[model samples]
Target: VFRSEPPDDLSSEKDRVRVIVRVRPMNTREVDKGDRPILTCDTETSILVDGPQHSRRFTFDAVFDTNSAQ
Candidate 1:
């Protein structure tokens, strides 16, 4: 009952899984207690920089900073 043949290349086009993150801004309570930004983001490379933990790099497909509205 098929009108057209299935895709010839059934294999997945991408071999890697992309990551995305949304960084929420600190609440009033956190600010009162001296809470700080632990993660810094790179929009160009979609990387997250964690300040609390040791130096490290996290790759992602997208990143939404606290100031992002869309």
Candidate 2:
């Protein structure tokens, strides 16, 4: 499912396409294999990727997580 925010006012906003990021939930197969989720969306505008060696945060126009509604 996909969800979208209302468009911004063209008169006040810059002309640019929004960059959205969506993080899907782990599938049953992956869960069965004991794989854990590494991506997390703590806010509407950023995502965090947790890795073995390092963690990185990416900012975007919008971000959605596994629990986000359409």
Candidate 3:
């Protein structure tokens, strides 16, 4: 949250306020080795920016969950 007020020296009577919020998925990395030789998986999210007084959200689901063969 951000708030701003016009300088006192200013003759105009105005004030400004801004708010921003963002949500994203955490990152995950996994490595495994098997008959395939080697395997690796990684997941990440990019940063998002919204206009003033805006909200953003992101969600993702895992297709498969397994233990590392290493």
Candidate 4:
């Protein structure tokens, strides 16, 4: 999530923006291809990055991988 500090004129806590992601599970055909997912995510820390050829890191609010169920 993102946080935005309020102006001094207003008395309030930091404003936040919540982010959520849902990754669909790979189907049978995709499994047969043996293709690998390019990105990996850490739900707890909201971090996503390329599995190979590390170039950059992306931070998120939350992430849901294929194994997760609604």
By lDDT, who's the top model here? 2
Candidate 2 lands at a TM-score of 0.73
Better of 1 and 2 by TM-score: 2
Error of 1 at 33 (Å): 0.2
Off by over 4 Å in 1: 1-11, 14-18, 51-53
RMSD in Å for model 3: 16.7
Q: How does model 3 score by TM-score?
A: 0.19
lDDT by residue for model 4 over 1-62, one digit each (tens)? 43322235643336565557766777788889997665565555354555565634455557
User: lDDT for model 2, on a 0 to 1 scale?
Assistant: 0.79
Identify the runs in model 3 with alpha carbons over 4 angstroms from their true place: 1-14, 29-70
lDDT of 1: 0.63
Stronger candidate by lDDT (2 vs 4) = 2
Over 4 Å off, model 4: 1-16
- Model 3: lDDT equals 0.29
Per-prediction TM-score:
0.60, 0.73, 0.19, 0.53
In terms of TM-score, the best-performing candidate is 2
